[model samples]
Target: MTKTILITGASSGIGKETARLFQAKGWNVIATMRNPDSESELSTLENVWVTKLDVLDLDSITKAVNDGIQKFGGIDVLLNNAGYGAYGPLESFSRDKILRQFNTNVIGLLDVTKAVLPHFRQNKKGLIINISSIGGKITFPLGALYHGTKFAVEGISESLHYEVEQFGGQVKIVEPGMIATEFSGRSFDFSNDDSMVEYQKIVGALMGAMPAMAQNASPSSVVAEVIFEAATDGKNQLRYTAGEDAKMLIANRQQYDDATFIGGIKAQFGL
Candidate 1:
């Protein structure tokens, strides 16, 4: 019997690649996004079940979970992949924007997991794959808010694993370093149009290098493969680091304590 997986943020970036890969592997892929129709390419896949979901919206998450359970017979895997980066100095970001980041990246994921747990516990078998970022493990300039949200995911995923282990449910987090995605294009509240005067000196330099960073990063395929491994592979580890850069990142963090490691990271960002 083919397994079924539900992937959020499936309209683009790593989520899109993951959806395509699972469909090819013969798993029933439920590709979810806030607006499914925005990406016509996803609509063409016969094995994919596209649904509308906004992570911040509880009604949408609950309804989508029910709809997925009905069609797929219960989701074997749930990929929490809907999150955006809110880059720039902490001072430049509004409280509302920071809250939005945490809501989608941290709380929204929890809500989705809550919606899907009953189904998983019923079967006593399921995998929860969370797409966290390397920023979760390491600090960087102009990414304090984004990193905070991801760090929450890292902690939440770690905690949930132990909580659900007895029930045969697993939670795994994927930490990817920068990847070639529209995150740069859709950087929430990190305005290219309006510069923050206070941090423009560094922010401008960082923005100028943003394009280079995207180019040096791995493609979505790197993250997609790691997601597949985390979902289906054995050993059931709590975390999977995606991409070469991410591997090096985890290594650096493990090699040094907080002060040294974080300072190294700060240096890397030219802060």
Candidate 2:
């Protein structure tokens, strides 16, 4: 049987890898992005139908969903992978920044899920895997708001699993640690507001540690395989950690209670 899958934020990173992975595996891919033409790598793929979908725009989401269904018979899985990083301190972060986080991470995800529910209900079975992060469970000093959005994804995805059981739909969350993507370089899209400048000591340490952190993370392909496994055989498990780093991070999160964690963070940056 041919399975159809819809992936958002397919322009790059983990989403890009998943699009290619599934397409090679014989799955019909409806890959959506804010701008499709710019995604030459994805658009050139024979199995993927790259389309425009600005998650921030409700109508764009609706159109993309309809387009996916039109291109493929019906979507068997939907991977909500669209998101951006917002850095800085809570006090310094703008409400607009925070709101955009929720809007893109929470509301946009919910809208697309809602758009797909009826179709899944009609099909009698479907899967939804949301891309969360290690930060979702254990956050860092300056990542307050981005962590909040991931936590929201965790909460929403788990609960939706409960709500959709009667309808034969299942939901799962895939939390990944730092991967060797342009996530750090390109994903730092937030206004880099002078968030914790007052706490220069703490902030500087964290900043210095980032270069090392990026070096250690695995490539996006590792995370994509995890998503593929979860989507293929996700028997109602609520969450799957995408990489070994995520596994260790989640397992020892409690060991570094705030004080130790911050200390280690500072030590890395030579603070």
* Winning model by lDDT: 1
lDDT by residue (tens digit), candidate 2, 1-271: 7898899898888899999999999899999999898878877888689999888998999999997898787899999999877876667667887898889988899999999999999888889989999988987667777888999899998888887787888998999998886545566653444544676665666677778788769788999999999988847588899878788878777677878876765555576
Candidate 1 residue 76 Cα shift, in angstroms, is 0.3
Weakest lDDT window of 10 consecutive positions for candidate 2 = 187-196
Model 2 misplaced regions, further than 4 Å:
190-197, 254-271
Candidate 1 error regions (>4 Å)? 187-198
Residue 115 lDDT, candidate 2, scale 0-100: 91
TM-score of each prediction: 0.93, 0.92
> How much lDDT does each candidate structure score?
0.85, 0.84
In terms of TM-score, the best-performing candidate is 1
